[model samples]
Target: MAHITFLLVVVIITALAFDFTNGFHDTANAMATSIATGALRPRVAVLVSAVLNVVGAFLSTAVAKTISGGIVNDGLITLGMIFAGLVGAILWNLLTWLLGLPSSSSHALIGGLIGAAWVGAGLRAVDFYEVLEKIIIPAFAAPLVAGLAALLATRLAYRLSGRADEESVTRGFRFGQIGSASLVSLAHGTNDAQKTMGVITLSLISAGALPTGSGPPTWVVLTAGLAIGLGTYLGGWRIIRTLGRGLTDIRSPQGFAAETASATVILTSAHLGFALSTTQVCSGSIIGAGLGRRRAQVRWSTAGRMAVAWLITLPAAGLIGGAASAVVVHGGTAGTVAVAVVAVAAASLIYLLSRRSPVTADNVNDARNVTVNPQPAPASN
Candidate 1:
């Protein structure tokens, strides 16, 4: 009993650490375009994202419930398995952050759970059908749908406001960007923070802290929300640089459209208990918005890199989690200490590397070849 209690505490702390990374890692999904377009200052944009994230957490926990209930058959899962899964997710997040790849944090977590569970209790531990219906189908579909929506919204915003002064249109849309970005942030909270909540709750379930089949407790919700909010404020500028300027050139109107599209898709997914990847969905939307402009340049190399990252995220995270789980389950307390030491060392190394190539608000805008909200060059009729 004592061992189980202690491990549960350790898992909770680790889960929040992962949640913090999740926040900064995916913050770009909500604010990258706004920052690129001067719709909001970088600091201000992240602050709004942080707050809305907290509010969004309260919007629903259907996704959380799915995570807590769906992916792995909870009856066969143990506390060590959950811990191993979190380790896998934390490691993957750090690796991607170092490489400036905008991978899906949500998928990493899901994969970790899947891998850990499979190792602990074999294939029967996985609820493949539910995983297929809820996670897999949307994994392929959400991004395309989000991108198309963004493309159409961009076309509409331009068509309706085409007659307005270029400066006026930008000014008006900047205000609109704030509102839309807020929605994206809120939607993010509903989706991302709940992932941690689900993990923590599952940890509790594995440790028998909560009765089986219960959603996350209020305390669990608040802690998960706060961890992610703090991470959002810290801001992963490397990821932001890749997203804001690398994938696409975001003008004010396009930024506005992309954010609006992301918010709608994510909110709907969370409501439906589908934990969609904000990184993928938002990145796709940005690319689609870029394509909406006839004269805009879209960078295919960066997009390809992101797609590759997406393909590997789940399985990579799972393998890491599976290995870690086996060690922790058999080795006990010393193993826990060893895992902690490894995590701290890896996190510290990533931090040191981040300083060498820092990305800030001033430099973030400089990364792009284009500036905010330019007049589209007249096309040949």
Candidate 2:
């Protein structure tokens, strides 16, 4: 370990903050279907997901290595740039959450880092090839694969149970959802939590606290795990409603297929060191699951909105990250302080606005809560 600077401290804390948001934002990825199907109560689902997330964090560090060394030239960047990137990621996560959109938290973090690196150290600092190879290609491919798999699995599940008692089949599938959803949660920890570990490790390397290319230390893994686990326990009910009920009306069979497909895809990507988006994969699976069930309707309107959010996640977060980098890199301590204050203010505003029409474990499954609705103006005669 090398000397830890104040800026380094800020970067690590910000990275963990981003990780916390990642947990809640992507909680729907694992537990949404299960909750929607009543396989588990909302609070219980999140609690189970939260615990699996912590345990999954200790499973692997391959994705962490990729973040620390593969995407950008850590040699060319500084602690300020990293902090700026984290700020961008955090803001995007919060904004999308407020809208009940299941955009990609993984992409937000990657795009922020890319934009900050490009601004701070010029284009040379960003490895475009690695970005395309590791992040871009997988982003498009993984979801489609998961969706297709879920579709097939759902079809097969129904076919096999066609002659069985409908009530018993639904009940059995619901029971199975607990296990499948748990696997997705474990997979979520393996992939998403490692991303924060990677970011923190990158900051450590930039600050000379760890040698370049070193993986996250023990403390980094533990803290990242705990932060995300806590966030998972809190849950993101707004997004959960969007995924669970908005995208499609999920039954136990469809929920089981979706969760199984999502878990398989996410776990495979984590092993291969691809920082894929669990949100996208899970959403795609839900859509597939909808298409598989007879007479089930996939809401393209809500899906369209979600798709647009996903398409813009990278560039949107990048622009914010680039702008933030300019301020932090050019303004010194005062600049960092200013960025922090603005971020806090913005986050607070989102939180307060969310409370005006709050979604919680209690009403997360209500049909009216399918999407995040703005508060209705007072009625006038």
Candidate 3:
């Protein structure tokens, strides 16, 4: 029992580490557009996002319940399995972060869990039907819904204010971006932080520290909230650069529209307990906003690469999780140590490589010409 306690402790720490990565990895989901449009200074944007992320984590546990009970059979998960799963997620989050690709951290966590569960206890351990109904369907549908909503909202925002002076209009929308971006931050907390809570809860249940069918404990919610909040404060400048500049040249109006659309979709899914990808929703909204404005160029090449990352996120993370699980199950504590050392080494390397072309707050908006490119072809002729 003491050994089980020790393993549970390790698993919990690993889970929190993944939550930290998730926070920075997806900070762009909430704050990118606002920063791009100068609605908030980069530091101010992340500070607000960090506080709201903690506040948002307390709003709902429906998503948490879904994670603890819905995706995999709780009976089969071991502490080591949970640890392995998180390693998969953290590595993937770091890899994508290095590339400035806004891939889904939520999907990486889910895929890692599914892979570890499947490998640790065979295929029966996973609930494929629930994964389909809850995760997969939402993954495909949320982005499209968010994109269309943002497109419509962007058009409406423009049409309603078309006769107004351009300076006044931009100023008004810049102010509006602050509020809309905050909503996205709040929605993101409710959706994203809860996944970590679920993982911790699942670990407790597996170790008999908590009863089955239990929700995350109060302490679990608090710590997970704090960990993610801290990470958000750090910000993911690379991804912020990608979403704020690489996707399109966003104006204040479009930034406001995209943020509002993203918040609505994310909040709705959280309420419904769907573990959809907030990254994809925000990215799609940005794309939709780009398309909504007349003559705005949407960079298809950057977007195409992002799409490819999304498509591959699940399988790639799953493979890593599966391999880690196999190692843990067969090699025991030594295997767990081996995986940890390797994950740390890989993450350090990625961070070093990222320093080669660092995207920091000071120059986050060093504008890229999305229209006439020295790089990929523009979406517009």
Candidate 4:
């Protein structure tokens, strides 16, 4: 029993660590466009996002319940399996952050859990049907829907204000961004924070601390909220640079439209208990906004890279989780300790590498240095 308690404690801590990474990693989802368009200063944006994230966590537990009960068979999950899964998720989050890639933290967590569960208790342990219904379908659909909404919103904003003075119109949209961006932050808290709560609750159930089908406890919600909030406050500058500048140039009007579209999609999914990817939604919105403007150049190369990252996120994280689970199951407590040490070491190395070419609030929006040379076409003759 004491051993189980210790393992549960480890799993809970690791789960919170993953939540923290999720916070920073996806910070760009809410505030990137606002910062890019100068609607909000980078620091101010993150601060607001952090606070709203905590508030959003308390909104509902429908997503949390889905995670704790929907994806995998609770009866087969163990504390070690949960720990291994979190380790996989955290590593992937850190790696992607270091590379300035805005991959889906939601996908990372889900893939990790699925992989660890499968390895720990065979293929039968996973609920493929639920994964399809809840995660996969939403993963593909949410972004497309949000993108269409943003495109229309952007077009409408332009059409409605076409006769107005350009400077005044820009100012108005910048002001509007404050509210729309805040909504995205709040929606993020409600959606992403619940993922950690669900993981912790699942651990408790596996350890017999909570009954199966139970929702996250009050303490669980509070800690998960705080962990993600703190991460958001710190901001993920590398990813902010990528999303805010690397994808496409954003104006105040487009920022407003993109953020509003993202918030609506995220909030709707949260209400439905779908573990949607906020990063994908925001990226789609930004791209849609870019396309909505006449003669706007969308950076297809950067977008292509991001799409590739999204495609591989699940399988890559799943492989790592499966390997970690196998190690833990074979080597017991010592194996768990080894995995922890390795994860910490890898994370530290990535951080050090990131520091070599750091992206900070001071220069996050400076995309003037970026140059894309167009390929010359072969001579027809």
Candidate 5:
């Protein structure tokens, strides 16, 4: 019984750690454009994001319900299984963070839970139908729709502003970007933070601390919400650099378009109980915003690498989760101890490494252009 309780503690702690990483790692999704376009200063942008995120966490519990019961069989999930699953997710998140890839921490957690459940309790432990209906279908659709919307919106904005003075137009759009970016931040918290809350809720349920199938409780919501918001305040400068700089230059207009697009998709997904990837949606909008410009360059190589990372995150984390679950079931208390040791070592190492290549607010906007050639081929030449 004590062992079970200990595992439950680990699962909750690990889930919060993942939530913290999720906040900083994905902050760029909502506020990067605002920062890039000078719509909001770095400090102001994060502050807004943090506050909106906290408020957003209270808006909807539909996604939380989906998570508590949708991805894995809540009944089959023991506290040990939950702990093992979180281990897989935290490792994947750290790995992607080091590479400066804006991969989906949400998907990592889902994949881990699915994998651990499958390994520990067999294939019957999963609900493939719900996973497909909820996660898989929305995963493809959300980003594409958001990206196209931003593309059309960008085109319209440029066409309307063609006769305006450049400085005035940029200034006007900067103001608009702040409002839209704040919406995206709030939308992000509503969607992203809830996933962690659901995980904790699921842990509580499996441990018999809560009912078998219920949405995240009030305490779960508040703590997870605050943890993620705090992490957002810290910010994910490496990813902010990659997003704000790497994926085509983001101007005030582009920033406005991207934030608008991201907000639409994120809010829509939350309403429908779909667990969409904000990272992918934001990246796609960034790409789409680039395409909206006539001469803007799209670095397909960087995008290609990101696509590969997305393709691999789920299955790779799943394998780790499955293996971890197997050892956890066999070794019991000893395995829990080992998992703790590994978690500490891994977390310490990643923190030390990040300190070496520290990306701060000062250098977060430094452009790392991929193309050497300045001009592009004419469309109708």
Candidate 6:
């Protein structure tokens, strides 16, 4: 009993740690465009995002229920498996952040849980149908739908204001960007924070502390919200640079359109209990907004890299999770300790490497260093 209690404590703490990483990693999804367009200062953007994230966490538990009950069979999952899965997710989040890649934290968590469950309890432990209906399908569809919406919105926004004064339009949209970006931040909290809550709830269920099919406890919700909020406040400056400046150059109008589109898609998915990737949704929206504007350029190079990262996020995190689970299942407490130590060490190394070329708020909006081909000049009559 004492052993089970101790393991549960460890699992809960590790789950919160993963939640913290998810917060910072995905913060760019909400505030990147606003910061990029100077609609909000980098620090102010993150602070607003952090507060809205906590408020958003209390809005819905539908996504949390999906995570706790929809992914894997709780009956066969163990505390060690949960811990190992968190390790996998955390490592992937840190790796992507270090590289300035905006991969899906939702996918990382899902893949980690899937891999750990598969290795710990065989294939039968996973609910493939639910994963398809809730996770996989949403993963592909959310971004496309959000992209199209953003494209249309951007075109319409420009069309409606085409004859208006450019300066006034820019200022108006810059102000609008704040509200739209805040919506994205709130939507992010409602969607992403629930993932950690679900994980913690699942762990409690596996530990026999909570009944099977139960929602996240109140304390679980509060702590998970706080963990993620704190992480958001710290900011993921590396990823902010990537999303804000790497993918495309954003103007105030496009930022407004993109953020509005992203928020709508994310909020809808969360309401439906689909664990959609906010990063993918927001990235797609930004690209679409770029395309909608005349003469605007999308950095296909940076975008291609991000797409590749998204494609591999699930399988990559899963492999790590599976290996970690195998170790824990075979070597027990000692193995868990060893895996945790190695994960911490790896994370530290990545942080140190990132410091060599840090991306802080002070320079997050520095001129784009990557060379992009200039759009060809329009042909003269």
Q: Which candidate is the best by lDDT?
A: 2
- The pairs that clash in candidate 1 are none
Q: Per-residue lDDT for 1-381 in model 2, tens only? A: 222477788888898899899999989999999999999999999999999999999887565454634677877778888888889889999999998899999889888888888998899989889878877788889889999999999999988889556788899999999999998999888877888888788777767788977888999999999999999999999899999999889999999999999988887876776667889999999999999999999999999999899988988888888999999989988899899999899999988878877889998988524334553762420
The candidate, 2 or 4, that scores higher on TM-score is 2
Pairing residues by index, what is the TM-score of model 3? 0.93
Against the true structure, whose TM-score is highest?
2
The clash numbers for all candidates, in the given order, read: 0, 1, 0, 0, 0, 0
- Model 3 worst lDDT window (10 residues): 369-378
**Candidate 2 at residue 196, lDDT?**
89
lDDT of 3 by residue, 1-381 (tens): 877777788889989999999999989999999999889999999999999999989887664554534677767777888898899989999998888899999789878988998999999989899878877788889989999999999999888898657888999899989998998888889877888998888778878888988888899999999999999999998889999999999999999999999988987876675667889999999999999999999999999999999988987888899999999888887888788888889889988887766778897888542221133442332
Q: Model-by-model lDDT, in order?
A: 0.83, 0.87, 0.87, 0.86, 0.80, 0.86
* Candidate 6 lDDT, 1-381, residue by residue in tens: 887887788889988999899999988999999999999999999999999999989887674454544677766878898888888899999999988899999788878888999999999989899877877788789889998999999999999999657888899999999998988888888877887888788778778899888888899889999999999988998889888888788888899999999988887876675667889999999999998899999999898888899988888888899999999999888888888889889889988877766778898888453212223551320
**105, model 2: CA deviation in Å?**
0.9
Cα error, residue 1 of model 1, in Å, equals 2.4
What does the lDDT read for residue 370 in candidate 5?
Answer: 19
- Candidate 6 ranges beyond 4 A from true positions: 61-63, 66-69, 211-215, 367-381
C-alpha RMSD between model 6 and the true structure: 5.2
Model 1 ranges off by over 4 Å? 59-63, 66-69, 368-381
lDDT of 2 at 153: 95
TM-score of 5: 0.91
Instruction: Kindly list the per-residue Cα lDDT of model 4 for residues 242-327, writing each as its tens digit.
Output: 88888788888999999999988887876775667899999999999988887777899898888898988887888888899999
RMSD per model, one decimal = 5.8, 2.6, 3.9, 4.8, 5.3, 5.2
Error of 5 at 5 (Å): 2.1
> Model 4: clashing residue pairs?
none
At residue 369, candidate 4 shows an lDDT of 25
